[model samples]
Target: MTTDTELKKEIAYNIRAALPKATSYEDYRKLVLALAESGDTTGDKTVSYINYTLLNNRRMKRWDKTLKITDEQMKGIKAFSGKVIWLVLTESWCGDAAHTIPAMNKIAELNPGIDLKILQRDEHPKLMDHFLTNGARSIPKLIMLDANSLEVKGEWGPRPAVAGKMVAHYKKEHGKLTAEFREELQNWYNKDKGQETFNELITLLALENVGNSANL
Candidate 1:
């Protein structure tokens, strides 16, 4: 098996090569709209053919609203002093990416220490492969890296843990994600209001800080 150091070097080199293909959150939104306009679709599921386009469009609007950051979340974000690069792997057609990216963008915007960059997952297969969730290439993976050292501090992705569990439960019980199931997932997101996502990411960052200190 490859060591973490070797893996980071490889991922860093690949990111450098693929960085040019990355876009800003706003650009990603534009791309999603462009594809929707052109009737392009994504994902492996057959239903994705019809739903990806509509969901992407809907997510764009969902992300446009101001995400409320709790006082505790704000404190945690502000306390981090390290300069880090938040490299996010995603695609415009990914419904999950559409829903998750905006809140992440808002969080990054809150801290000057964090610089967020959006990279298309398909365009950077090597890096995306390194962070696959359950051997699958999940979208909207936020990889935190030391700004100067370029070492990966930590990662969080695809969806909040609570949502991930919900997905797992649904998959186990229903066997597959249907159109109705997808709607149910969206309803969960609506009720959660991105709180779980924010809390999870903040926890990851805090752990990264602890790891950094341990190494020192």
Candidate 2:
């Protein structure tokens, strides 16, 4: 079996190569528009779906301006005395990515120790396969690693806890992730105001401190 450390080293190697080629959020915004205007059927309806996700992300980013962390979250961030890398697997068209990434960006901005990098999910199949949610290739999955050792500290993703449960309940009742369910999910994000996502991440990051015996 590939040990966890070995797997993370592989993931870090892939990330180093992909970071240079990965598109920025602005660049991805342009690509989504270009894909929509191309009039090509190469990806069929995927282009249209991505276009919708891009637009939704724009809205979420704007609304994410009010993201604020609690005192506890600040303390958790402060406990990290070493540099950490936040390597995230995402795509421009993932609805969950649209809703969650802006707040993540904000969190990274709060701490100089945290360096954030985004890579497209489809482009990193093996890495994505390792972080599957319910055996699905879920987007917006994130892995936290030690900058020096490249050890995987913890991971979180796809959606915040409350929103994830909402999705589960919706899928259970509706039999699929339909448009109605998606709209409801976004609505929940709007009301939550990124609190759940931020809280979850702070908790995840705190685990890293506990592992290192940092004063928390």
Candidate 3:
């Protein structure tokens, strides 16, 4: 059996391999928009997936336009000096990715040192396996890597803390999320205005201590 260290090394190797293929936030947006136009999705091309892709495309556009980072959050993001790559795993049909990735892009825009790369989860199963949330494949998972060494420094994902709790509570109560609940979650995301996601990301950066450490 593989030890934890060995698994980490293997994950790092997979990340390096996947990095070259990952798209910039701009390119990923273009891809998603094109898919929306073409009635297609990244993974299984079913009607439901296609419809979701279309909806997410619209959702992402709204987020990209309206999501705001507070002055304090801006300062926190700008202070991160370490050269790091935020490799995100996601897909076109994922609603959570639609809500959160634009916020991530906005944060990445504040720091030149933070390179954000987006990859399709299905395309990089090995890398995705390492960052699974609760043993389940969750999209929009952010894997923070040391730019020079490719070491995994930190991670954040799927949903913000409050949203995660909401999901867990709903799941515990209903055993699954209903369409109505999913709509409620989206409404919550809209009301929150990406503040929670931005706050959590800033916390992750502070915890990583990347602001104080120089890139080697």
Candidate 4:
């Protein structure tokens, strides 16, 4: 379990490092509730990510990447000239990354007009330059673009001019997402609840929650 001190420091670092749009306390509340609702009895983090994402949001997984946009989908995206792009830089093992990628898939499901992509941060270090250099290196940045004009519209956190908003909001409202929260979130990632509600959410998010499911 992470200590409160460590959690405080990381939360502070996240505030300093990221720039997210000033989300309504509603957004944070839903996010936290979704995470809390997603936890597993077995104390596993991976299972939690899958369950939380499915229950609360949507996203998809690619071959090696737990959360990604498929090649066939990319081909369809690039074919057009002016399209909005929502790209997330992530890797499956990353804690934040695990949360993010699947969320994108869910977004895609809700709004087919938008386009989504997932890039591995380690594989493409250059991508990090776009969001945040901070070591927090939170995974799964949400990038958006105008589908018709193909201009970038928005993104989630850690970018220049972006971290300020997240900082301003969290400073006033969040009071640091506690270690207990992280612990609970981590718990959701473990074990097999095997509930259909959880599985359906995984499918909507395009997440491979069941590695065994892939075998079939």
- Per TM-score, the best of the predicted structures is 3
Instruction: Give per-residue CA lDDT, model 1, range 1-216, as digits (tens).
Output: 989788768888986776667677677777777777776754442555546766777776766675789999999888776688888997666767767787788788888887888887766788889899999988879888788877777889889888899889998998988889888888888787788888887787788777767877
Would you estimate the TM-scores of all the predictions? Answer: 0.86, 0.81, 0.96, 0.37
Count the clashes in each prediction: 0, 0, 0, 23
Give the C-alpha lDDT of model 3: 0.91
- Kindly indicate the candidate among 2 and 3 with the higher TM-score: 3
Candidate 3 Cα errors over 4 Å, as ranges? 210-216
List the pairs of residues colliding in candidate 3: none
lDDT for every model? 0.78, 0.73, 0.91, 0.42
Q: After superposition, how far is residue 174 of candidate 3 from its true place, in Å?
A: 0.6
TM-score of 1: 0.86
Which stretches of model 2 miss by more than 4 angstroms? 1-47, 214-216
Q: What TM-score quantifies how close candidate 3 is to the native fold?
A: 0.96
Pick the winner on lDDT between candidates 1 and 4: 1
Ranking by lDDT: 3, 1, 2, 4
Better of 1 and 2 by lDDT: 1
